[model samples]
Target: MVQTYTSPIRVYKTPFEFVMAAYEKRFPTCKMIPIFVGSEITSEITSEDKAVTVIERRCKLNVDAPYLLRKIAGVEFVYFIQKNTLDRRRRTLVIEAWNESFASRLVIRETCKYSVHPDNDDWTCFEQDAHLEIKSFFGFENAVEKLAIKQYMANIVKGKEVIDYYIQELIDEGVTHIPRFVPTGITEDSALDQSGIEDEITLSSLNHMALGATASSMTMDKRIHRDSLYKLDADYIHRCLGDLDPVEESRIVELKQWLQEHHKEKIPSDAHLLRFLRARGFNVEKGREMLCRSLIWRKQHQIDRLLKSWHPPDVLKTFFPGGWMDGYDDGGRPVFVLRLGNLDVKGVLRSIGVDGMLKLAITICEEGLVKCEEATRVQQRPVSYWACIFDLEGLSMRHLWRPGLKVLYRIIEVFEANYPETMGRVFLVRCPRVFPILWTLVSPFIDENTRKKFIIYGGEDHQQPEGGLTEYLDGKSIPKFLGGDAECGFPEGGIIPRSHYLPDDLAEMESGIDSISINSESLYQSVSLVKDSYHEVPVIVHDAGTVITYDFDVCKGDCIFTVLFTTSAVKIPSSTPPASPALQTSISVIHPDLKLKEVIRPIPCSDGSSEQGTHVADKAGTYILQWKGVDPTASTAVHSQFSFDFGLTSPPKCKVMYHYDILTQDEFRGSLSSVQSFSSLSMA
Candidate 1:
């Protein structure tokens, strides 16, 4: 595979002539770049007027590769053929180089240019680009390619610093200025002798040049702030987007430029784009796809207007245990506190369902963005993220309710996809024994970079004077509930009232107030089963290695769930066929002489419980998921506290909401059991 890299244009705040003189001193070898072994000029030429020069050299570089690979390739130092063309008349220099070792198996080419800045004659601009392709590398093609690019980018990052170091050396040596070349029909040596003298300049001309440079810089800064954005200025990037390496800076500039060309009217802020880039590890293609999908979601949901048009339901405002505080963190970031342990996840889900919970989470994310901007303005620094405190004092098994977890997973997906890197820090304080269960299920989905921001405290140690919340937050900002004197303005959440549970009809009506009901377009479907009847869904499988996964919540009464496959020549309908006599009674329509193939043995699902599992199809056939309404009295476990608030009387209908997705063997990355402890369970 061939890879390419392009660097953003870098400006040197020095004259072109002076920069070139410092650049020339870097030839042969330099201490700043130890990997650059040496170079030997093979050819050299100069025009009669000394206005142009060309040189060719063979350069040797120490390869930074594993010893085994180096031995296999039989080389320690790689060689490159470099050609340089300098035009003094035009104040430009172009350098091109290509690898000389393993030319047939690998290719590495680079081009670098230095020229006078377009707007200012006194300053120089530098740009570089490179291409690398590894056709074969002794059965280590991918490893070699990665190593080559890593080394290449490292050199590029160091190139400017090397030049600056040499420039400072020249300054300390009293070689501050070098005369620009003029066509005088004189030899280069004669011009070099007079280069020591500074050119005479009038005070008026000096002032005019300084003022012009300043004005041009100010104009560029204003352009960056204006809607009609142009190039990314180094100062502007550092001031607004934080520090980034040369490669990262190039990616941001490249992605931003692409957006400006393709999405001119609705270009997101650089900070927004940066979050997506960071999420995808700066892979431009991946970042582009993620950003475009998020943009489409925003447009479809009208999320851009959510802050102004949407209002939280009274139930949420009173029962939700999370809100932004008036105080900032030690680093000047906005702070948000969530009493997650005190939250009634089951109550909230019953009150608003999955979609309402998703809307609330997304709204908080949007609000965090606004607060970050405000903090940035007020703190006079780049505040792109906010700190969060999760007080898990009363956390328990109820917080791990499957439906609630499902909602959390969905919200995490949305946040990771669209709002990456927005968390500056997370303090998980007073985490109880059950906290690991919740963390185990969600941590895999969190980006590793974001996970590193979390600070976990297992008990009341967070109230300590050292190595605690006080280390990251102001003392006065600490809530009184956490042993502080300050009064936390957010609600003190407790068990939500049973009266707050909204029926389906009422929840739907309330959701209309905000266009954020995910269930309205949910992929999952719900079914009501009467006693002695079954609900079935048929899925067609064409490939043998396909994986079928099922997740369902038993919302009402007890039932038996089973997965089966058919080998007989019976036709399967695309949609869910009506509960037939064979499916309801026998679990299969295969011949009586032939044995039924049961992929998953029937598992008893009790009231208010959830189950999820996966099966690999052994053959291409019709796979059916059948749920049969069972007598709740048959299962002694159903009579226990696990039934939650359900009464003893048999309900007329048992409800189940389910969703299924198929993945090819290659796409099935992991087993949920590895991350989640529950194979199947019900909680009272």
Candidate 2:
């Protein structure tokens, strides 16, 4: 296989003629490069007016390889043929080199060019391309390829340093500039037109120097002009995108070019493309696929306008305990603090529902992107990711509420899919023992690379002098609650008041879960119940000893949930039909004469909690799961007709989202704790 490498354009703060002088200094032999043994000119040519020159040379270099391989090759050095073409009139130089010693066994070709910068004529630009193919190397092909890549990368970095050293040396020796070439019989205006430069005509040789020519500055400039979209700067990559290896750099260029060609209307920023590439381990195909899907999602959701158009609801503003810190971390990344211990997860879920919470989380991510761009400008460096500190001091089992966790899992999926590599670090301070249980449940859903970024601390470990927040954040920026002086303005969240919760009807509408029908987009179904009236769906079991599992959340009001089993077929009412055939095989309506054997006694359920349980069938029969809405103020069930007497105005309604699954005894694997009352099924 042939391996190729292409480097970003490197700019030098010097005129083309002055840069050419520095290039000439590297010929014959130079001690700066130890492997560069020597070079002898094999051919040379010059134009009549000294405006163009061409030279060919045979160069020798010691192979930087293992001793065993060197012994096997039985040679002290290798030879390469190099050709240089200089056109002073155009102010450009091209160098081509290829290995001569291993012509049959190995093929190495390199091309480099130096020309005037398009944006700034006073500055010079250099670019390089190379290809290496090792057909055979005595069964050490892989080792040889690795060594070649390592050596090539090292040399590429050193090449710029060598030029800078020579340029400085010339400056120290008081040689500031070299005049551009003039063709024979050319007037002054024509010469200026041909070269696009004004130079003193006196200094034709290196010995004679012209002090009037503008002196080139030695300091490096790291910024690239926005207009030069086709070219990438090496310094800009180093400063803004972090250090990338040669192959990774190639991948970025390739992917960027692909996007420009295919999606020219809107190309993502380099940092965004890089995030996807990193997420996919630099595999261009996988990265492209992931990025394309995310782009479509963004368009479909109108994510670009989210920062300006979307605002957090009043509930999130008042009860959500997460916010971006006013200050940045030591690495200049924006810090976001999520006070999980102070968060009332169950309350928030009950108040807003899953769809509302998802929208809020996405809004936060969009805000993070904006802050990241601002930080990059303010800090004058790359700030593509943000840091998060999760304060888990008061975390408890209530946070493990199944419904709330479902919302949490959904948020993680969206973040991983659309916002990869946006999390630079995660600090989980003051984590309690129960935190691991939570982590175990959610960590599997997180990407391995992302999970590696988590930094957890228990008790007072985060306040310790070593391996603490201080190591990553400034002392003055640490929150006061974490043993620091800074005041945290994020909400100190508590349980939300039930009065603030939206009505059951409004909540269902906002969540897009129509209680009247079975939604194919969602696995769970929702239903609304009025006071005294009960809802029943019968499950037909064909196999005995099958396990039936049910999970549900009461989104509004209060209710009692019970399970019933009877060998007799339950009568169906024409007024209400089963929503879907999968879970609700048959339906039953509330009737005065109806009586069924109760398997699981009525268990009270209310807003802000999730209930889950499993029951094993002793014999094949029809089992019904029933929900009866009860008055919030009453201990005894009220008859359906007089339910409004307890309430002054209107009848109260309860809303629930539920799901059920049946598995054979041998295939049942339950995640939650089993019900201890499974053996206490009573027939009444």
Candidate 3:
């Protein structure tokens, strides 16, 4: 297996030539860096006119391993070969370095480049990438790899400081500016020319530098800036998050082109495109398609207004045991805490309905975006992500109760699709053994890159030597309940009081959607009839020209639906009971007593399809919404067993998910703009 690491671009305020002079000071010997024992030039070559130069050196390093491992490997020192090429005409330097000590058992290679900042040539940009592979390590591959990463990260942070020290030293020596290299064929005088400087600094002999003079491949489209909410540069992603690779730029280019072709209205920001690209492993095609669908869904739902419009129920706001902290987790990124065991998943679902729960989730995520931008201001860098801490102290199988599992899945699906790359770190402590059983069911639905960020600790692994949570969080800021001194001031989180549950009707009206679950209980039932069976719900129109809107989802199976108007108005007896609005289609079929005035049938809805439409009623009368299934194949119920044969009768139980509402002439005035604000059908 191989591991690769890419560092953020480290910029020097000085020009490329000055930065190069500072970088050259790190060779030979440096008291500031103890591990860098010494370096000696093994070979040096320059172009005939000094336009380019290539230098190869052997550098020695003292590995920071235990004496025991050093003895085992029988090596007192580790040597690496470094090769550098400087192209004066191109204004670039490319350096490649590799370990020569353990060439057989371990393969390590690193590449660093110093180039003129494309935006401002006065500034220089430095980028580094390292790849490590362990073929054989005497059963110590994992340990060795971890050690290498730790040391590598520690060394990268001090790199900028070292360069600054040397740059200041040059300034102290009064050698601040080095003339830019200009190609001048062999000087006939071989002495001071018109510039009053020596010929060695000219670009005539730089052809020998072999700096791969094709120029960097990075490019940015001008159109990307116009649509972005933030100014985007080639290194915009790296500046924001402090970690991005070269290929991400290429991936963004591809995704940008795809977005232009498929969805022109969605503005392209480097930060936004990078999230989708990273979520899908840099697969530009897949990322764009996923992004396109999400954009359309957002427009349909008006999710862009979520932050300003959504309000969670009082019960959810107070007792849900989940909320963002007032401060961050030592990093500028916002911190969100979820007390899984304290949440009343089933109770909340029963009180607020699924739509309300989704709205609440949106509120949380939208706030998260605001927090990220705020963090960027505080951190003085791009902190475009956040952290989460999951406390499973009271978690049990009941929290995963089957009644709410479907709703839970829906929430996860919505969050994962819309809020990509928002999670920076996730800490799960005291996770019970049963958690994995539920995780196995949910993991398949999570993105692979996201799943990798989950870090869970059980038993004593919570504290002490393991530093479970401390590994990512600062102990000074750790909440007191989690064995730190900080006061969380949050609730203890247990079951929510059932007495506070809102009436179902109020809950439905509050969320603006009256959704009915199509699970195998009612909407899906075996039909063994020999002839067509119709189920209808009656509606009375008080006046003409009212717009009647109907909405329904095909949750499980197919069913034929049509709106039928009764020619004659019939009043129901006072003693009769009100129809159950949920399964209200049980009324007997209309035959000889009334005539079918209108048949409003829509195209068949496939799985997961939602069909909604409106019609203007021209006359006043009693109406019936009919849902029927009558296949002409057989007399008995069709077999429920799986079969690919299309000629056979339909499945025994065809599932139909549906909901609807009516709007008066006054209400439909602004229905075009306020469809989401309209109240759903009354359970009355």
Clashing pairs in 1: none
Please give, for residues 524-643, the per-residue lDDT of candidate 2 as tens digits.
Answer: 777777667666777888889888888787877888899988776665654555442222322343343445678998898986557877789887888888887777766545554455
Q: What is the lDDT of residue 46 in candidate 1?
A: 98
Off by over 4 Å in 1: 35-37, 40-54, 62-77, 87-90, 117-121, 140-143, 179-250, 257-265, 313-319, 330-332, 342-356, 373-384, 394-405, 432-453, 494-504, 508-684
TM-score versus the correct structure, for each prediction: 0.64, 0.77, 0.46
Q: How many backbone clashes does candidate 1 have?
A: 0
Off by over 4 Å in 3: 185-239, 242-360, 374-409, 416-684
Which candidate should be chosen as best, given TM-score against the real structure? 2
TM-score for candidate 3:
0.46
Cα error, residue 412 of model 1, in Å, equals: 2.3
Better of 1 and 2 by TM-score: 2
lDDT of each: 0.78, 0.78, 0.67
Tens digit per residue, CA lDDT, model 1, 137-163: 899999998798789778877888988
